[model samples]
Target chain A: MNVTTGQSTDAARAIAAGRRSRRWGAWYVTEHRLRMMRTYTGTVVIAGIGSPLLYLYALGVGLATIVDANMGPDAVDGVSYLVFVAPALLATAAITVASEEFTYPIMLGYKWNPTFTGAAASPIRPVQIVDGVVYSVIIRMLVNLVLFYALMVLFGAAPSPVGFLGIVASLLGGLAFGTVIMGYTSTLQEDTGQLAMVQRFIVLPMSLFSGTFFPLAVFPIYLQWIGWISPLWHATELARVFSYGYAEPIWLTLVHVAYLVALIVIGWAWSRRIAVRRLNS
Target chain B: MPAPVIVARDLVKKYQDFAAVDGISFEVASGESFGLLGPNGAGKSTTMRMVGAVSTRTSGELGILGLDPDVHGPEIRSQLGVVPQSDNLDTELRVRENLLVYGRYFGLPRKLVAQRADELLAFAQLEGKEKARVDALSGGMKRRLTIARALINDPRILLLDEPTTGLDPQARHILWDRLFRLKEQGTTLLLTTHYMDEAEQLCDRLVVVDKGTIMAEGSPAELIRAHSTREVLEVRFGSDHNAEVGARLARAQGADGHRVEVLPDRVLIYSDNGEAELVKITEAGLRPVTSLVRRSSLEDVFLRLTGRSLVE
Candidate 1:
């Protein structure tokens, strides 16, 4: 009985230590997040919000006239071309923020400065370091998404109460992309143009082919696979299903959510291992 | 009596195929200022990393505060303060915020962190610059802030890895004084420095390491006396002269049967009495352009054993 109690006490001590380490790690992440926000908030607001707005004006207003005239009055769901593209724009903005927040910042934490080394030298453990970085990125993504969503409302792109659920979908999409890409970033050693390649070859292709600006039915059968696999496509489809009442099978929606959640779980486990190797080794 | 604050036996650390710290072992008694004195790439930093519980050793027994680093790294690290070779201060935060945030990493209460920051700032001589950003501070100021941040936990042992490497002479002196005060207050210090004078001035005992192994270990005076003569006579014989003076000086012997080393520019005559050696050099008909006698030091001891210049 005494031995069992001692073992339980040891387990309790370990639990307490783990909690303390996580608390320290959270503070470290908060400081990094706040510093990033203070320094880059203006840049993000301009690029994330302003760039999307400019793209919307230039593409929606300038090019819409010609496209609308060709496709006839009923071509765009009985709405303006601008309205048809607005929700897609919001989803795309969230994905862009996720890509930026996940890649270079994750690399910097692991390689450039190794802030984790200093933190781990304290009471914080390697796993907490990983958690802290992920938490900070999530917070940044949420803030950016909220701001973008607010701008969408201002532009009258939100069609119903269910339209607000698009922001949550966008967030889930961001987490899907961020987690998977962060795993890749943690394994990289050199500052190669690989991230740029991902942006150009992967993200751009997915964005252009995933029916963000048009319906997937308009695409060739071969190209339709892009929408089926793209997280942005899944998110935009879910958003449109909620916004315009486009019908999707319930199992299909579950598949979309499962795809994202599965990626997050797998990426999280891989990231934890990478953090331990990079730090303790 | 308290147990040894640090203990290592056959500790080895390898990076791929290269052994950075190859089976080195040593101990530091509590409250003693221990130094690892060596040239650049002599594995001093690697040894300190193992002791600080930041770098894992490949094989061997290691203990900090009587606990194994493999099992008790976080616990050991919490009780130890480390100042790395580089000033990795957060450039975005104010000087005081760096200390406060670092203290928070140790899970110290915010009020206690604030109080400790003030005390450490005063100790590091940066009390007035608390509000200034880290990037706005000078190199010396950044180094001082790093030191102050390290002390926030009031650790049982402090490890400094080449703390004065890039600082100017005046800045180095100030840092040395602060470290001396910490030593006086009975803080156990383990430092690595390539500067022999720094090791001599601050370390009560030190190990001279090279190629990841200890060459000698003792107090500075004791190591010098053990490996070198009491005094050394330096003779420079212009650029043109070489082996002729060397042959003559090699033939001449002092009362204690000491020898001389001849180089292209100078010849060092080792003996018990440097003045007597100077008389012998004159009598041997080798007129030198310059001559000086000085007491033997760790530099001389290192040169004798390594056959290489300390600074090079």
Candidate 2:
């Protein structure tokens, strides 16, 4: 074994680890997860850049022509169907990223690979680990949202001068959905394809029935309840208001903002509690 | 003990109705290599967790580095480095990155950690393999990397749980050498292993634990002197006749200290002069298929105290 010549005494370094922890612990953990994400950086970049382009090309040119030719180019909200649909696609992108980021990796951290236990042993708190995971995902989500918003402009889908504000609305929407899912994922001890089940049963249905491509009023009142409860619906409505100046009651717009923020708060707190219980046990 | 770094008294941990770690107490002083010797499910890991400040205790007291784990957990943990029983290296990261990232968790500076990671890689004898994928390394290399990762923060106390349990002899020796160097460098070591040879080789003092309680506590030689004879004569007879032979040996004239234990395949006779005692036993017409005399070991001490083998 080759050790360095200048070995500082152990006591000094040990005290340094403790002192630094109270200030920068969460950021360090965030730094670690981001490095883990870098292992598959190619996959994330390709999927982030490629998927949004495909969604826009398909819906903007192909589907917009059919809908506009029949509905006089203002079928919903006095905008082309593609323009109406772009924000929903971006919001769904966030959810897609959320589900992929939250489930199996969280399980891996806790059990399979148990990297979280390794983190738990350090001076950093388990709640910091939870914060770190969330921060890492938020970083990815923010990156994806910016790229998707750029593409939304390239496709001439976002027409309002302030269409860029949709990025913030979409990000908040994503967190509202992702954080809640993260809280649930952190509590899971067994996988058993449960995340896949959530993808198929909950996410797929929410995307289909949340009025992503059409006005929620088009659905019967009973089916509209799906739109009411779905975070996707809340996020999409907020993004629509920003993307194309889509008008609704002021109170209704406030409701959309309130709903997503509430879920983010609840889910973020739940995940922290779960991390404390599991890591400290 | 001089300037005891870790002090625990009547430490208890329970899960619902069952106590995983019942009232166990021990103290480890600065720079000492201490051990908890026990079989699987003996709660060695639980006690290590409590002392490591990763788990909360249900009752009793634990002071690590003069700080309480309940309130100063992060502070206590900062002074300790933990190598868990199993490797949890991030397969997503390269070999060197595992050390760097772990150092980051302790909130060390990136520049400091970078230099320390290289030094640790050298200390672990994997200097050129820094960029290798974690899964690409051999089990021995991975274990070494895990150990290196633990040292990234330059902790005062290093907590290892069965550090060499699954390694081959050569690999185990390599680890033992690395650990010996740490001990020489003034890093207090607290490890747990069921291998008596491991306890004897590494531990300056140890507690014999069974079912979450300490059965005995002392240095290896002291425990041996207290619980085992100076020599142990192992004699194997036909499987069907060993118990009967053991009974005869227990009462045989001029044989042993009169302490004999009958195992499934062999009989153990305890005496100060094993060779002479063996001669007396054979002369008494109690012959065996095979026999050997060896110095008493911690294994024998454990058997004497618990009426069971350490590994079984």
Candidate 3:
């Protein structure tokens, strides 16, 4: 009986030591993000950065001369066509970064590689797994937005002192889109061509209708509803308001900020719940 | 008295209308090599998943390392290592990067992770494949790497779900060797396998699970002895002649005069002395085209309990 008691005490001590040494889930997710960056750094630099800069130069500077010759001096905004489209380009870059970084990467984490499963087998809980993934996406979006903003300034796309706010607006736009799309990605079990459909049907239509390429007033009254509900439209409107100081009521400005903020909050909560269900169920 | 390294009481896991793991209870001691032996869809994997704390139980209680998974999932998991049946290696990373990244998930220091990665790669016999991409390695190499990655945290309990299901003979032998070494080092191993040979080789004591419940549990020899005769006599009198031969062999009994089983291709006569049965059959003028006598094994025990082969 004494020997058995001694054995039981030793077992209790070993288990106690085991519980004390568990790893945090955040460390696991950060490692996955770093590995992802290493694998795709070359592609990100060439496609994410290079393509946007080339478009800015080719359309903003190269084609602006042709448009200026056809119209009077103030054909765009009492400034060159290049200057008018520059801030819009900054907003566009932010939306693009959000779309690219959020959807497929979230799918990869949940479905394809299932690194989260590996992490869950450790001391990290499912909620921490969700937090780590969101944290990584936010970091990536900010860095990419900053680099894109710098390029916009260097290329003479940003025309006003308030144009710097376009960077902040772009990040807000990305956060709104990323948080929402991550929620969608978390519920999906299999790939089933949904991601491609999102890129083509959803992202393409939103980019076209959100006034990134043209003024929102040109659209028919009913069609304008597409821009009104869009986070991109809100971001673009905020960027235009800051860069050109568009005359608007204080209530209207508040509405724009409210739209983006609501998206970030609701999307984040929904995604976190979905992640917990899918991973821990 | 050691409080059992793993303990469960009436653990149940249900998926919608179906119960994947019905109410079952068991305990495993520290440093013991235990096995869940069963066929596919026998609920062994589901049981392992519950023990690993990845799948939540529908009812009853389960505790790993003296902690409840519901409240302390992360705390319990940190001390446990799991090798899933399927190889889900990160194909994007190199062999060495896989181990290093897994160590980092446990929040190991960078220098410590590097040192452990080197040691594990060598231990898994993947020393020279460090820089090689996962896709570039063979099935066996990838499995070894996964095992090494699971051990990066120096876990006390290792759970393996069919560790060598789809490997070549050489790879299977290599894996068996490594597992044997780990067992000798006093690591508690819990494994699931449909292969009786694998269970016989590795498990000190095992539970034969069938359709979500344990059919029997004991050491290999004890199980065989308890559920099967000491020896079996197999006689195949051609394919179509089995029925006639079975009738004749049934009349010619063993020393204890037990009945015989008639199979499609052969007849099995269960007895303590198979050679004596064979002599009685020959003296009765029942000439079989082929005949053999062998000791009963765990396969027979499984067949007696479940009425099906272990693999099928």
Candidate 4:
């Protein structure tokens, strides 16, 4: 019995809704999101499988032969261009999928459709909603990254035995970028082309300048900052370290991990804070 | 009286300099059908949100089921069902899936939620809509489905914010019938509405609100009895002459007599016997364009308190 606030003893201890305090509330919201994503299962599957297959075939087989013939047998760091570009392509997939999951779909949950409010009306807190969304999108990214890695294996681009670790690297990379956008979207009361503007000005420029198809050193010094700051570049660099054993200082490798992790922590905290404020306001 | 299931004291909600809900207080006993009656922008929805434990009060003390909402928000919300003013149903899921998903949000057992979803679908008259998409349902069906979804967790209190705002007459009647049954079953129901008829039909007691403050509070009968006469006699002397005729009628009734209300189209004479008042008006040599006598209702009570029509 909390006498000061008038909360009853029986009511305080006897948590009622589905039984007690919501230990699994976040997972339940994740299940709902997964079911909603089921409506677009076809698109997810085709994009997951088709994008990797198409990109790998064109770059690894068709273009890699030209580069290998012109610049000698081992073109990049004594390895074929196919091996070097495959890891970047995998990280790029992570960023692309993360951006798509974080933008309009978030808009739909908070404004255009507002199913998140319906969830918030129950015992589920707003922070749980944020965690649930992150979990579901992480699941989607896992499946896609795994498929991309499998194609890299089939194309013989993954030379080292530990190249499968790139999937974990790419997953972190997705969260690093995705959660920041998720936090930003939670504050939108109404959309007046802001999200589309974000997609155009931020997402498109990120993939291009992150050295996806070429080495950052060839892009000159001033423009290299784009690669240095972009999550895609750090993730791609980290993935390249695993696949075909691309050479870099061990400390620089640790910096890539720390950078993506810092982004994830900051972005995730920002999202939870903003979601709770907006929903409880 | 039974213990109150909900209570609010000096509840205020502000958005910067603009106050959406000014200082107001109310209490609802167990199994009671309470309502907040007001026009749009009168703080009814804001009050509902605070009571539902979803929105934070700017300054207030609120207790739902004996727990402070600010402290035990998840606990209080778990026991309450909220039907928002707008339908926020998931368009991506099937109709029954909406119920199941919402029940799961409360962490309810899956098997129990499934069974209740079927029963609630039947109760909402959406028996065959288990697999139907939400977008396919009609307006009335969607409202019913929303109600059904709210009940999936078997909440002790149901909070409906303007439950029948956009429905047609037939749809409103059906929804009212369902609400009446929920009341009969001893569910503590709290609702907000602008329609006097809706208040008359559903609320056991209600507060008349205007401009973010409560103007009056009572049952429909008691409010009408206190603020209005037994009957009202409306005399239309044409819109052009309504003002001068209203002044002449005021003189006929005298300053101490019953009230004469001049609307844009007609003059309403509030008295015990409207027919007798009409007779007196005619004998006084005022030839009205038309006349009618009707019983006073909450509509008249609201007009008396706020000096504005309920629906306008």
Point out where model 1 deviates above 4 Å: A1-19, A22-24, A45-52, A55-84, A111-114, B239-244, B251-256, B259-265
Cα lDDT of model 3 by residue, B1-312, tens digit: 545778877789999989988887888988999999998999999999889988899997787776677766766677788898987777778889888877776666789989999999999999889999898989888889989988888888999999999999899999999999999998899999988888989999999998898899898888988888999889889988899878766776633567477777888888889898889878878788988999887877887887777775
Q: What is the lDDT of residue B181 in candidate 2?
A: 94
- How well does candidate 3 reproduce the true complex, by DockQ? 0.42
Question: Which 10-residue window of candidate 3 chain A scores lowest in summed lDDT?
Answer: A1-10
The CAPRI quality class of candidate 1 comes to acceptable
The candidate 1 chain B region of ten consecutive residues with least summed lDDT is: B247-256
lDDT at position B159, candidate 3? 96
- Model 1 pairs whose backbones collide: none
Estimate every model's Cα lDDT from 0 to 1: 0.79, 0.88, 0.79, 0.88
lDDT string, candidate 1, B1-312, tens digits = 655778888889999999999988888988999999888888999999888877899998887766677776777777778898987776656788788778877777789989999999988889789889788888888888888988998887899999999999999999999999999999999999988889988999999998899999999988988899899988888867756777666776534478667766778888889998888678867688899999987888777778776787
Alpha-carbon error at B253 in model 1, in Å? Answer: 4.3
User: What is the C-alpha lDDT profile of model 2 across B1-312, one tens digit per residue?
Assistant: 465778888989999978889999898989999999988998999999999988999998887766677877887788788999999999888999899899988777789999999999999999899999999998889999999999987888999999998899999999999999999998999999999999999999999999989999999999999998899999998898998878877777325345787889999988888898789878878779999999999999989998998897
TM-score for each of the candidates? 0.89, 0.96, 0.91, 0.97
Query: DockQ of candidate 2?
Result: 0.44
Residue-level error in angstroms, candidate 1, position B258 = 2.0
lDDT of 1 by residue, A112-197 (tens): 75566777777677887777777877777777777776776776666677877877777777777777888888888877899888
Share of reference contacts found in each model:
0.29, 0.62, 0.42, 0.62
Error in Å for residue B189 of model 3: 0.5
